[model samples]
Target: MMSITYRLPQVRNLVTAFPGPKSAELATRRKAAIAAGVASSLPVYAADADGGVILDVDGNSLVDLGSGIAVTTVGASNPGVVAAVQEAVTHFTHTCFMIAPYEGYVAVAEKLIEHTPGDHAKKVALFNSGAEAVENAVKIARIATKRQAIVVFDHAYHGRTNLTMAMTAKVMPYKQGFGPFAGEVYRVPMSYPYRDPEGLTGAEAAARALLLVEKQVGAENVAAVVIEPILGEGGFVVPAEGFLPALSAWCTANGAVFIADEIQSGFARTGAWFACDHEGVVPDLMTVAKGLAGGMPLSGVVGRAELMDASHASGLGGTYGGNPVACAASVAAFEAVEELRLLERARHIEGLIRQELGDLVGAGVVGELRGRGAMMALEFVKPGTSEPNPDAAKAVAGACLAEGVLILTCGTFGNIVRLLPPLVIGDDLLTDALGVLKKEILAAG
Candidate 1:
């Protein structure tokens, strides 16, 4: 069992209604100071968080099912991460790894090599966020393959940067009004088992996508084939079995780097070191973030040695690519996962969530219960039909929040309520949160 050392109480307590006076006042102030485009799902203002509970300014402790969007797998205030960050800060903050190399950066790279999929000689490049890691991954692939075209899957979300926005599938929020995206970024069909045509096997799905790739953009011109092993923003959509392996094989044969964007699914979130490990699919390049540093902003691209080294000297780096504090936190985060055996915890959480929500499917309150390990989701749909019921999703999330549980919703159609509870959450707290989720989901019906 993971040791819980944070001061914040683990229990969910609703001392006042959700978003009480203090939080409502803060929301008003935030509206005045913050940009209109930026949005928050819940109105509650977090004062402190630990383990599975986020203490709001109004003295309400909300069960944190979202885990800061899956960035806090080891918990929001893991003791190891806190100690490491503090210690690293006392020594020095930033020397900019590019200007003067540091041991923390190298150490993080080494750890990533050991943890990410594949046993082959691999190299790593650190970055500040998932978007930066993805951008750098594409850059590396393009330079290494000497090609310009990059292939992305339908409903894939790479990031918010210019190039990544171009690669992303959604339009209304991510890409709308951001015109003239990066060139030569092609999109192909994804193996979304729930949404794909009936009876399409994983190999068949790969063939369909490959046929499109061959017909439209010659495989020779493709630099990278980027995909989320288990789609994150795309509704936690786990593709059909063998889909990843087929894609990997195709990329190897076609000279296109298979980039697994395991930003949300990495770091033992999917009951494994990485989701790609589930299918024995070793990606040529893997971009990771989110759970890397126990809520610290750090991302990296670990890949085969040749592809990483193909870049010219000083071609890949940023001033804060590998900050010492973030690196230290990342090292501690990895240790916490290992020490706590979070992979098994994630699987345990998955089993609990599936068992708790299983009845909703038969009741017509859920369309699908999908995803792996701690990264599970409930796709709300119109009762007795496959059509998306985004309203039901919204209702369920609102009901959960009102009752002191924080859940997040995501999907191409916005009908998925993804559950990403901290792996260190106590069994009692997890069960209680799931109970709240179940009540709200059924009530929505």
Candidate 2:
């Protein structure tokens, strides 16, 4: 391992307003060029970022807690990632790995085989986004299994694309008018422990779900059962222990593929290399993106060699499937994660979150504190019931943004607040961000 140094100076704000004058002017112009209804979570624009801090274009500096939706675990504006991306861009931006074939892309694929969970022989196919990785995964699964029905769990968010919209469970924003979705998609109940019936353990849920799948779709008809190791948009739902293992076992026996959507949970997000690694249950195929290339547009499908080879030659690939510049950044990100022991750092983040925020479940501010490692969330609820408190959750996020900390909310119920901080965040910086969150929660009620 080699030592890497990066600088992140927190410059004081000179303007009275958070966004100041310049950002406001830019926001007005943004509405003209961007699509209608498009919005941003963090209003304050970033002029620069390094490590755990965000330097706003308004000259306001704040500690970044969201890590751009868990994309920059090695930290925003990472020195190594920057250097590697710079060098690759200088050489050649894009020849498309599928066409010209570049080492940078090959390097990323090699890392995926080396780092992604499972000791089995695996192959990788690159893509542009998590959704792309997911869409491509389904294509491969259907091609391999010769089955049309793709089974996805309820409350899952595969993507915003047409096919994925049909797979996505949310109705309000993701799938309201975006009708006439892709065919052959089936939805099933997710193993949500917080709201599940009493007396039903994780294993029980698996049995029930398996029985349902067997009954409705018929195991042979289903191509693949797509799952998030820890459910992402479904409020960071951590299925009961043994639940995922049982599901994977059922898939294996039934001859249906288990596709772990680790887009949000993979690449050392949840304390482990992959959330499935915690249980030692490997998926037949997996979708990865989010933090794959330190914020560049890069995703991939890594699966058993035979399964991946199932697709006929030239059946899988994209024009920009493996952009060289993005692949270069991915190499740096992987090296940083390995050398910095980010897996251990993620565990420490889990401890801090469970301590400060998890304690609030009893205080009525939190109904559920679920998830693993850096990929944790707190669900707000009206006291003494399972009813969601979406307003309170939204308020908490709003207050955090006002204080210059960005937090994201998810869940089909829209009552869960999630944290996806950088893996390289300092102990004090992380503790302070958590303290800010605690204060807002306490003040909300």
Candidate 3:
């Protein structure tokens, strides 16, 4: 596999303290201009980024493990994506697919159809963000099924849109004060092996969730059952072995659409084209974004043609959905993934991370090491107990940031530190970053 050529040096070098004078000055300007509601995890201001490193204005090169929330699977500055975007802009910026439908839009749709799970006749509707894709998927599911209730899992995070906010589980940041949200969304238990009762099997967990749906919202009233194959923001939780298959089976038997929100786990981030592929559980409607466009804002809902076509002609669309430049980037991202063999690269990253951090489980600092491929995370907990330790997670993340390594934290309890490095990241750079992570995690104890 060939790696993308990046001009920026792929080494972590801190020439000045993090958020140095330049970044501090920018922060002041940002506070004045940007909304207070918007927050950034790191204080540094990135001037340039390529491969595995982000260069701050202060001349510090930080090793990136977050991948901008898993959007840059092919690296932030991939040559193919950059060239495609540049060439596309020269031809035309935006004609709005809703106005003068462009070939790039159709091409991206075609790519989505081919890559997304299932061989069934599929159609795709593009959108500007993952939230839009998810919202639209729910809309499509409701229209197709003529049902009123949507089922979601506990600790699930669909998005922040009104309807998605109703679908999401967390309250503080994503959903708090965001109401009144759309109604008819029901929550059920997810098969979180790390937290589930001892000796609970995947099938048993599915039965429990199904029983709740049956008792609360009848199967006849359910529009769709949406879940993340490998839950994102809710802690990179990889459901138990038979959980996904069981859910999919239940959805099939109940006439509810099984929608896999692969926004954070798609595009080779989880060592597969999609996480659903790991279990051979094809979703009726799959919402995709994040890594779809190599950092360009683009998202889509790809699924059964019958369901996608159920909506009225103008029922689905956005003025900026499937923008020409973004479509070009998406196409190039697909090519980059193919040429770089990012699926294999993701698996390699998983092996490396597991090998480096697996010992934490025995040390008792890590309650569990979950997730797949590059989308891995460490759930920090009190030694010899499952009690969450958000402080430990924060300390480890902060230490890594101070040492010029960028990491991200998630989970309902905020006790998990997620690692989402770009697939193009070099082995040496990844090793160095992991070393920093190990040292900090150990020190946190």
Candidate 4:
């Protein structure tokens, strides 16, 4: 028997079906919540979580393959994380760092500078979410370059804020009818290798993008070219090696700041501290948030000292940007990553996903299998056709959920099945989750 501490996370089923009697009763209350627009895509109602399994209020245990949208790299309900949160909660809940400031905030910033890529003198500004970090990165760029135009890429997802909405690309939910966005924002075609015209290498793709920027937007007038080193909401797009380097070089040559939105790809998600490390192309600035606090709301823009200092002293702060409790949690999370050797686990996770689902790509049911380390996806399509098969992907995902595993869908076409399990998941648990996922993909065929 697993210890009580460890056993709660293991798969244990007592109810007749997934959402047992107790969960059904609470779901009625949740219906009221849904009426208020608070319900979520997954309705398991986590009673507890450890390792990788989330125990629902219904008494069923399902694997958490999504990792709360890649925020919990060190696992949900980790003992260390819980202890750190509880300790901080007892001491004080919220004292706005901008008002009085505290060591917790200072410590987290130190850790951010230490962990974030680049060996140059660095500084950090904390925020509440990925969107806020993106907005702040924009502010830093505009201030540093004294330019108004911010450049974004196609199919990108920066945030929901007015400014980030302008930077974001997709139209339906993110931009639909939410017009009058922040001004001077421009769009560029991202080098999504899977969809790019045949025979276009990464370098050629970057050169084409730069030429477009120069011709249309006048690169000299642009303030920043914001990019996700590994595109997150846009199907985990991993540009070939030469792509980022070329883009960064272009930004440097043109006097535009290169802002790497590392919110989704940073913190060892892609087998590196930041995906930009894949090509040794460090950005002038970087934004991070999702996994920084191991689930708490804490994010920061860490970058070159000169650039970070460029902003006026009081121009970059907010009331709750860096709460003391969240900062404490972030400190613990940073410590956990190094002490737990979680980077190796991320690489191991990539291996497991590839080993299990790789043959599906050749079978042609899968359009592509892409991404790095733990941040991976299997994009589905109509067999022998390039068209996306979102319906088929949905059916497969439904099957996985029914079989007691949770998987998430992504991609511009909504045909990609992404796997982002906790980096600390047990090997046996990951093997079981992948086994279920493989069965569902084949069944979808």
Superposed by TM-score, candidate 2 places the C-alpha of residue 197 at a distance from the truth, in angstroms, of 1.4
Report the lDDT tens digits of candidate 3 across residue range 85-110. 99999999998899999999999999
| Residue clash pairs of candidate 2 | none
Residues 25-76 of candidate 4: C-alpha lDDT, one tens digit per residue: 7888877766753436565677888778888877788888888999988777
What local distance difference test score does each model get?
0.92, 0.86, 0.93, 0.84
**lDDT: the better of candidates 1 and 3:** 3
Instruction: Give candidate 3 misplaced runs (Cα > 4 Å).
Output: none
Q: Which stretch of 10 consecutive residues in model 2 shows the poorest summed lDDT?
A: 9-18
- The pairs that clash in candidate 3 are none
lDDT of each residue in 177-202, candidate 2, tens digit only:
87999998888788888889976787
Q: Rank the candidates by TM-score, best first.
A: 3, 1, 2, 4
Residues 169-224 of candidate 1 have per-residue lDDT tens digits of 99979999988889999999999888889999999999999999999999999999
Cα displacement (angstroms), candidate 3, residue 31, comes to 1.4
Question: Which segments of candidate 2 are over 4 A away from where they belong?
Answer: 1-5, 10-15
TM-score of each: 0.99, 0.97, 0.99, 0.96
RMSD of each: 1.0, 1.7, 0.8, 2.2
